[model samples]
Structure formats: C-alpha cells, structure tokens
Target chain A: MNNDHNEFMWLDEHHEVSLDEIIQLSGLTHDELHRLVENGALIPNNPTDDSWRFNSHYLVSILTLSRLKHDFELESDSLALTLVFLERIRTLEVQLQRSQHTNSAPTIDE
Target chain B: MKFKDYYEILGVARTASNDEIKKAYRKLAHQYHPDVSKDPAGEEKFKEVAEAYSTLKDAEKRAAYDQLGKHASGQEFKPPPDWSSQQGFQEYTFDDIDLSDLFAGFAKGKGRTHQSGRDRPIPGQDYELSAQISLEDAFRGTTLDLGFTVPEYDIQGQLKSVPHAFKARIPKGVTNNQKMLLRGKGGKGFHGGHDGNLYLNISFVPHRLFRVIDNDLYIDLPLTPWEATLGTTIKVPTLEGAVNLKIPAGTSSGQKLRIAKRGMPKHNQEFGDLFAVTKIIVPTTLSDQERVLLQQLADASTFNPRHHFE
Candidate 1:
C-alpha cells in the first residue's frame, strides 16, 4: 500500500526527543535508564528541565542499546560502556569512507 | 511440529541448575548476538538461543515444558490431549500451535502479558533504511519512491508485516548517512499507542563528474601543456552546469581552482565551493610536426621539473 507522507522531519539537531519519548522508545525501566545515563550513554541538552530531551541521533544509539540489553544479560552500565565503543566504530567507518579516494572520474577522450 | 531440545541447544545438561543454564545462555548469547558477532548465521543462531533461554530462564515455563514428555531432537510430536486443561492454555486446535508460542503463554502467567504489558504507552517501532541518490539529485533535493515493510498488530495483537510504498521528498543538503526522521511514518502503534518514526539514511550514488567531501565537490580538470602555460579560460562542469574557470599562467598539476557556491547546498541556504583540481596531460603519441615543435620548445625552454633533485 502507498503510505505516503507529504511532510517529514529530519532527526538532526533541530529535532529533539523528550525523556519520556526516549524511555518509551527504548523499553528500558527507569532504574536501568538512569544507570545508562549515569554511565554516559546519554546526555540531555537541558538537564535542568523536568522534560529534559535528547538529540534525535541518540534514538539510534538507545535503540541499539535496547537490543544489546535484551540479547545480553549485562547490566545497563556495562551495556552503556559497550555502546561507547560501538558508536566509535560507526564514526570511524564514516571517517574511513571520507579518507578513501574512489577516483570515479570519467576518462577524457584524447 | 519438530521438537527442539533446549538443553541440547544451550549445550547444557538436562539436569543443569539455574546458574548453569544462565552461564551457558550467556556464553552462547555473547557468541551469537547479531550486533556483536561476525558469524554469518549469528542472527538466526541468536534467535534460537534467545528463544530457548526465554523458556528455560523462568521457573514456571520450564516446569510447564517439562510437563510435556521429552522426545529426541527434531522429532515430530503433538501436545498431550489434556494440555488445554493446563493453566494459561485454552482448549484450542493443536494442529498449528507452535511450541514456543505455547510456552510463551505459560511464561506470561507471572511475567509481562501483551494485553497489560503497557502501563505506559509504548511507541511503535522505528525503521531505518538507506536511499542512494545521484549527486545532482542530492544538490537539488529530489523526491524518491521509497518503501518498507510496516510492522502492524492484527486484531489479536499478533505482529504482521504490511509492505508500504510512498514518495518521500528528500531535503537538500543532507550528507551521506545523515538520518531523516519521518514522524509518525514508521510502524503503526498498538491500540491508541504513539506512532513510531521512519528514519531514512541518505547516501549518494558515485558520481562520474564529482567527488563529494562533505558539502563540497571535487572535479578533475585535465589541461594541456599549452593551456597550463598560456593561462586559458576553460568551461568546467559543475553540479548546476558548466562554468568558466581561469587557468592562470604556470598552473601546476594538483592546483585547485575554486568556484563559489557551485557545490552542494549547506546550512542557512549557503552552498559550498567547488574545487577543480588541475591535471596536466601530455599527448601520448606525437606526430612529426608536433614532435618537431615540442623538440624546438624543449631545446629553447629551460624549465627543469627535476630542479629539486639537482
């Protein structure tokens, strides 16, 4: 079926996900969630606000964390530590892509 | 249905204690988790391990599974006639009932139930997919025919995959791997629950004319020896079209001539600069006339490229 949407928003800096929204998205309990944050998996842009929100990119990270938590019986703190390395690997892959020269230019006929 | 030996799957003894089962499960899970493991069969192996563990980890589910008479691995078997009389399972046709689903029903007794699983509403699942567009399309922000399988809940709360196709207007200035979240366009939520998001990870197809680094574009501009020395204005192809670029006198190979606002669009409606890297090309074969002219120039001109070595 054609489930077309005329408008869409990017999950960039402009779009932020609220704390409640993240908890719902991640399926982590409050205690587990707090441990994850305390272990440095998430940092809110506004920590003072009751409705502190996260950058939307963290949605991918949190979702990945959720899967890791479910698949492995590790504590949230340990999972958050693993998340740090995984995110690094992802960033390194992108950086690696940038460094390589594909040389896809067409040949000029003499 | 074919029977699966949970103990055999985990490589644990049937008489293994809870701690022993937990230890076995952890080792196998670590090795088979799709995210961590590099094995080709990791995902399927993980699912099998997880499924087996889910049933065995709980006291009630394990006991209920033990109620069923054990059979050899992969042996075809049906549930006992009086299984429906047991707790959690109603008197339903056993012809199509999966063993995992049956045990999952038993485990739900003291655990989470799908009906009451949400004290707070859970958002629907978000989908992430990649779309490859041309550099020109990325510069102009084109619409693409995008599609994904939407995970929806049926009337009985069972999950189903509904294939969905739609036109998506990819915004300009989105770099490779930049994620765009289409709000409420992901998997549909369960009864009155919040809708999920659709994440589109943008990637550009390799362009023949341009090499993109961030917002900027790089193009190789091949120049003749005369053009390099005489300083000629040549048309350089850009994403928009061709623009005349000045090749200054004594231009060297690998020197970049920049064109303003001719690259990919960026924040604040500003465009990045396009760089034309100069490459001095010489004729592979020289005719007699060309050879004589070149010989005369070689004899007259005293430009030594190997001056550094000297």
Candidate 2:
C-alpha cells in the first residue's frame, strides 16, 4: 500500500546522481541503451524527444536486458517481445479476475 | 465428440465459392498459426485449422467430409448399409489422429465406447474473483480474508457447502482493477488433473478526503479568505500523516501546492506528488466591526478577479 510513500520520498533527496550511477548499478552500456531506443525495442518515457533521464525502475529493466544479453544472447527485439508477452500474461490474468465475482455471491450467513 | 464442423469453424457458408473459402481459411490460419500468432490457445486451434483446410481444399475430400456432416469423425460409423459395397468407394486418410476418435461421442455412430471406464483427467477450470480493499489496507499491504464457495463431492454424493477462505496481500499502491494471482485456487481438477488458478482484481472504496488517479493523489484544501489574502503556514494531512506547508503571501483560490514524492509507493519504491488545490471560503455573516475592517481592506486593495473576463 501507499503507507511507505512518505517514507520513500527521501530516498533520492540529494538528486546528485547521474547516468554514471545508472551504468554502475545496472551495468549496461550507453550504446546498448541507444540501440534499444533506435530499434523501437524501448519507447522512451518522453516520446516527443529522446532524453536520458532514466528512472530507477528503468534501470532494473536495463539490468534484466543485460542478463538476457549475457546469458541467452537474445536480440533487443526478442527481449522486447518477451517483455510484451509477460505484459500480455498480466493483462489476461486481470481480465479473468474481472469475469469472476468474489463478493457478489451471497454468503451462507447472509 | 463429433469433430468440429469445418464450415462452421471457418465461418463460411457451404454455398460460398472456393475463392471465398480459401480467403476465410487464409485469414483464420494467419490468426491461429503457431509461428505468427501470440495466442496461448493457438496449438488447439492448429488441429482445427488443418481439418478445415484439408476438407475444403480437395474436391473429392470436400464432397465426402460434407456428406459425413456431423458424423465425419464417428466410431460405430456404419456407412449407409451399402456404402462401400456400392459402385464407387473411396476412403481418404488425412490425419494422424483417428477421425473416428474425434467424432465418437458426437454423432449417433458408435457412442463413446473408447472412453468406457476411462477416467480422463479434466484440468481444473480457471476462475477469477475480485477483492475490494480500503486505502489504508492498500497502503500498509494488509492481508484480506476473501470468502467464496465451490461444490464439494463427499461420501453422500450430493452438492455440499465447500466454503473456503484465502488470505491475499494488497501490494503497495494497489490500483483499482489491477489483478493479483493466487495459483491453484479455482475449480478442482477432475481425475487428478492440475488445479486451476484464481485471480484477484483490486478495487478500493471511495475515501472521504482523498481521490487517487493512477499513482497521484489529489485533495481539496479549504482556506479562509484571510489566509488566502495574507497567507500563513498551515498543517495539511498527508498519507504519511500531517505536514506543515508554507502558503505564499497574496495566494489566490485555485492555487495548487505540491508535496513531492508523497503520492503512492510504486514498484521501484518511487512515490508521486500529492497536489492540494486551495478553495477560499468567505464568511456568510460578519459583525459591524468586522464588516468595517473588510470594507477598508477592499478599498485599499486594487484586485478584481473578474477583470480578465471583462
């Protein structure tokens, strides 16, 4: 839940970090990031123009891609497609829940 | 069961031309093909695709599969007493799996003899259910006691109460309409089949003061006219509790104050901003002395909100 929102706000209070911090943490090359963007494998958060401000979560994605590239040698498109498949699975799971009713059914006590 | 009707499966009228049938098949094949499509159910659809195409592509096979109609895949398949015994007889074997196996239970032919005493394991039916939660519970990631029922077969061999409870965790910033999966919680599998999955859709009860949109939270902060004209530091309630916010002097109603990273806790532990919109309230009744002071202040200040409209 959101109880941690106030607590987490101070995580990046200094705001002194740079792309170098992302590279150090995620261990992905600048060229690889640019390639992912060029191939449409990644749609930048800002669509109008390309900016290099990556959120911490985006760094995690880069980390995942790095592992995929190292371990499986998957192309950027293939990794992107895999992410799309995972998203689809999440969507189907959600749709199934909407079709099922947990509270609408009457309880025995009721 | 009777093989699926090739025509119906392809959604084409029997009277349609070969070109029409081919077009329909091409479109459907593109959608259900394993190589090109992303449907998880594509494998099951592959069999159907092959069946329809084989039957429709050949003139002789098309005539035969059409004559068989619902019985194209039967077991007790007794051809019209003199079927093969007649003048022209042709038996076409197109599929690796026995066509009769597909039609055994469907048509009046041999009725399900192969399935005799066979305890087939029917995979459990997938089920979905939603849980509506409170904002605080969503924030704190509390467990919800969700209750539901299923039919339980017992020694008596009749439908019985199979009430069950599951404890579900509400993740931080659990948005409304989002789903959480609880595996193997749906209808029980038949004949020792794998149990189905249970999905939990997230929902939230409306809060008295806060309105959530995605990760952002919005709130209306009421301010006194005096506070709007001559601002002061005020205590505002946030999800994390209350914080003192400094209001700028000469602040006007409809001004927005943002408290950064105080909205919702996201997956990466990031938080959005909470925006507060100010609404200046005017006193309906005033004493003579209060009215005289306000009149003096109004005369001194040359501010008119409606000047832009004019």
Candidate 2 on B1-310: residue-level lDDT in tens?
A: 2355678777888777788877887787668765447998985685586567666766755665666545443433433444322313322222232442223112211211235523455455445566778777776677778777654333422223456676765567566555444556766654566665565667788788776655666677789888877878888888889888777777666666777877776656688667676778888999999999999998998878789897
Which stretches in model 1 have alpha-carbon errors above 4 Å?
Answer: A1-9, A12-21, A28-55, A101-110, B1-34, B38-123, B146-151, B156-161, B164-167
* Candidate 2 iRMSD, 1 decimal: 19.6
- Residue range with the least summed lDDT across 10 consecutive positions in model 2 chain B: B104-113
Please give me the DockQ of candidate 1 compared with the native complex. 0.29
The candidates' DockQ values read: 0.29, 0.04
lDDT of 1 by residue, B114-195 (tens): 3565333545666777889988888888998988766454455443456778788887877766777677777665546677
Per-model lDDT: 0.73, 0.56
Give the least accurate 10-residue stretch of model 1 chain A, judged by summed lDDT.
Answer: A101-110
Q: Among these predicted structures, which one has the highest lDDT?
A: 1
Q: Give candidate 1's error at residue B171 in angstroms.
A: 2.0
